[model samples]
Target chain A: MRATLMYGPGDVRVETVADPKLHEPTDAIVRVVQACVCGSDLHPYHSMDATTDGVPMGHEFIGVIEETGTEVSSLANGTLVIGTFSFQDNTCVFCRDGFQTACVNGGFFGSHDVPGAQAEYVRVPFAEGSLVPVPDVSELSDLIPSLLTLSDVYLTGYHGAHMGRVEKGTTVTVIGDGAVGLSAVLASRELGAEQIILMGRHTDRTDLGKEFGATDIVAERGDEGVAKVMDLTDGEGSHVVIEAVGHMPAYEQAYGVIRPGGIISRVGVPQYEKAPVGFGSIFGKNAAVTGGPAPVRAYIDDAIPLVLEGKINPGRVFDQSVALDQVADAYTKMDSREALKVLVKP
Target chain B: MRATLMYGPGDVRVETVADPKLHEPTDAIVRVVQACVCGSDLHPYHSMDATTDGVPMGHEFIGVIEETGTEVSSLANGTLVIGTFSFQDNTCVFCRDGFQTACVNGGFFGSHDVPGAQAEYVRVPFAEGSLVPVPDVSELSDLIPSLLTLSDVYLTGYHGAHMGRVEKGTTVTVIGDGAVGLSAVLASRELGAEQIILMGRHTDRTDLGKEFGATDIVAERGDEGVAKVMDLTDGEGSHVVIEAVGHMPAYEQAYGVIRPGGIISRVGVPQYEKAPVGFGSIFGKNAAVTGGPAPVRAYIDDAIPLVLEGKINPGRVFDQSVALDQVADAYTKMDSREALKVLVKP
Candidate 1:
């Protein structure tokens, strides 16, 4: 089976690898149909150490079940499905409470131990709880791109908005112009935010953000960006600030543009371990900070119907696509900002 | 007028100060009836720089209206009232949204310009918005202590419980054995929390916490405390952790005892300017951090009824009393931990 592997920073390869096998009774073998590079992948791409045995790469994908372990009762072979980036036994206490990302029996894919989805065949653990069967969309294959986003990005954006308590009449400011940020603009709009402000320097991405329901855009960064957003919001900051860029500057912007008594929801995986949360930031303003690795599994069931009904087209984030053999170029294109996201066909 | 003044670290004085005069059309002069030393006052007491002129101290009080400026309409002379530590024009947008502490025109008492409440007379700005009138409690004088707590401590605890979303079936862990932590225990019980774990080393305070509805008490700190809490919760952690202590260790303890997807509500005035909010603390757990200065004015109306009906007795936190001339001793007692809290009569 051909799979994507990263031997070190700036190194990606599509090489023949042993096919994934069901290692547990709760596992299922998935034949990958579509997968994509994630912004988070850039973290390792920029600094991952050289290794003899490369680590499997990619967590998001939509596939068909090629085989199922004996105990996997709910799913059958050949069934089309989408799974969360992290596999969980959805019946766990945390999962039942809508926090499947923290499921006790769960673990993320694409790690050294778990073969990733960007491959010919991937093994999915906790099969019944991890995979959500999808209606056959062979005739409407265009929906595949959008549905694939539910595996991570789109639902991550939804998690940001949901955690921020975005709702009717809320003024939201989203920091970052990545696929996740754009998805947040769409999610905020879906959640009925009255005003969506996208803070991004890229006109191309900001333009898409506008189309996705951003009522305003600030191309500046730092103090200038915060001033622009405050000016747009009548000197009061937005009710909710969604941070989709995993960096210190973006997190700072989140606090800067968050209204007093409002919320700062961060879906961005932080690049640093420390941030200001004292009287000067959150305490004195009576604001709140929330968001994390999204409970995408909890939202996938609902988001699928919206995508099917044409309520959203999150797939627009995928501006480029490549075959398995061109996987290295896909990483290069995204890392160099030539593509918003690159979908890979296996 | 006799007032309490902080000359420097470890130096408190009971001095005669000029009578407070109306400085704004919205101001009202209140003759102090009962003002209490607060846990926060210890901050300035421990590190304040020496000065020729001491700073007025104290922010919690219940009193009788001495006089009112022309614009003060809702409150009348001789009417007993309780006001939030921070005066706010309750008509402001933030105030209307139940965040009076962040009101645009609001300013806290006990600051350089605003006179503190531990005086014979204090001038309150935004009188109509800041003061909540109380029914004559002369016949039921015993309720005065409890009612006075509405101005700060008790309401601050309520803010913690409210921000943490404590409700029926919630498992709560309150850190700190101070007045606010005890108040949080009471608040959580009132809010229908099924399990209340009070983490404190002081048996006297923890006993009070138990009386206030703490079902369990962990007299440990740091890792041992975290271990004890986890053991009590069957290793899942509490649904909400109310941080009533503002130090980094307390904040760390909050993260330590929080369940995945839980909330860490902080009413403690943070002594530090930064804390860990990276994946290791908040993100990985899908938890939220919220709470600030209590919008006491917003809850005063609702809380007054609870006190009047004898449903709560927050004033029990005040275990000692001092006359106007003995105000200096009050601060010393609270500072030395010889008294949980001291009530000053001026």
Candidate 2:
């Protein structure tokens, strides 16, 4: 089977790898029909982790179940499924409480011992809790993009918006315009946010934001950006400030750009090994800040339905598509901010 | 009028200051009947603020309405009232929302424009908002402590416990042993927290914690304190962590000492300007942290009722008393940690 592997920083290659086979009664072998590069994938791609040899990459996918273990009952041969990026055992106390992402035995694909979906075939563990069946698709053309998003990006944006407590009539200010940020725009809108401000520079980024329902755009950074957003709200700031960029600047800008009793949901993985926090700023305003890796499995049940129903088109995020062999090219384009989301065909 | 004034660090004196008059139409001239020195008083008593010239001090007080402006309708002559430490216009958005201490026009006693209560008379602004009427008590001793705390410490601790969402049967951990922390112990127990831990070193303080409702105590500091708490929880930490000490070490330990999905309410005013936040730690665990100046006006309603009913006995906190002329001795005693709460009589 051909799979995408990271050899080192900026080095992604399509190479023949071991064929995925059922190794446990709770496992299922899936012939991946579609896959895409993810924002998180760029973490290792741009960092030292990309230098690791033969590390299989990619987590998002929609595929057909080629085989199922004896313990698997909900899924069967030919079942079209969306496998969430993180695997979880539904029986855990955390999972039972709707926090499956924090499940005791949860694991992220493409990290450490977990193999990824940028392959001809992949193994899904805890199949019962990991896979969501795609009910019906109005058109075949929509399957790839929608399916590609279920496992990571789209679900992540939904999770981010959810954490921000975005609701109808909420005025949300998204601090980043990355794929997750754009997805947040869609998610916020879906969740009933009346107005959203996409704070970014590039025309390409704002265009995507507009398509997803960003009512305003602030191309400035730091104080100016906060000022622009504050100006938009009569100086009260946004009701919700989504810190999509997990860094000091965005974190600082969020508090400055939000109202006294606002909410800031941060889902971005911090680059600094020890991310700095500002307690005085956060406590002073009586605001709430919370986020984490999207519990894709928890969101897929809803996001997958939206995609299949054609009510949402998260697949439009992919501005370009490339062969598995062109994985490195995809990384180069995304790292340079030239592309929004890229689809990788195995 | 003779008022408690700070001449220099650790130097307090009772001197004649200008008698307060009707500063605003809504202001009431209250003849202070009972006033107490708070742990926070030590901040200025032992701080640079004390080294300054003529700093008026004292926030906690119970008083008689000596005079009321024409527009003041809430009380009449000779009405007994327990004034909130911070004056707020109850009609403002923050006060209407139950955050009176943070009202836009809110004024804290003893700091600049908000005159301290350790005087013969105080200019109580927004009289309707700051005054809580209590039923007459035959035992004058039973009423002073409750009235003193109404201004700051007790209500602040109650607010802290409330913010942490501590409820009946929930386990609670209070991280500071100041007056507010001691008050939090009472608040926790009154609110029905099953087990309360008060982390302190002084025998008097620990005993006070127990008398108030602390079920356990961990005298260790930093990592040792956190480890002891974790051990107390069988390594799961408490369901709620009340951070009363405002510093990085205590703040960090507060986060480390809580289990997954715990609530951390930081009411302590951080001394180091700004403390770096633990973003990932909070997000990954689905935790929440919030709090600021106690909305004294908000909790006074609840606290005053508890006091009148004798459901909560906060009067025990005042371990000593002194004549108003001995303000200097009062400051010195509290600064040396020899007293938990001090009362002053005019």
Question: Judged by DockQ, which candidate is best?
Answer: 1
Q: Give candidate 1 misplaced runs (Cα > 4 Å).
A: none
| The 10-residue segment with the lowest total lDDT in model 1 chain A | A132-141
lDDT of 1 by residue, A48-136 (tens): 99988998999999988899999988887888899789999999899999999999999899876788888888899999999988956
**Cα RMSD for predicted model 2:** 3.1
C-alpha DockQ for predicted model 2 = 0.39
Which residue pairs clash in candidate 1? none
TM-score of 2: 0.90
Provide the interface RMSD of candidate 2 in angstroms, 1 decimal place: 3.4
Model 2: runs farther than 4 Å from truth? A21-25, A49-54, A68-71, A135-141, A273-280, B46-50, B135-141, B207-211, B276-280
Model 2 alpha-carbon miss at residue B338, Å: 2.7
Q: TM-score, each model?
A: 0.99, 0.90
Q: Output the number of the lDDT-best candidate.
A: 1
Q: Give the TM-score of candidate 1.
A: 0.99
- Give a tens-digit lDDT track for model 2, residues B1-346: 9998787777778888788888778889888888888776776665654345577888788888888888899788787888888888888755676766557787678755667899888888888888877647432656667766877888889888988889998889998887888888999998999989998888788898999999999999888998999898877678888888777777778778775657788777656644434444576666656677777787777677777777887777888888899877877787788877788887
Model 1: per-residue Cα lDDT at residue B289: 92
lDDT of 1 by residue, B236-314 (tens): 9999999998999999999998999999999999998788889998899889999899998878889999999999999
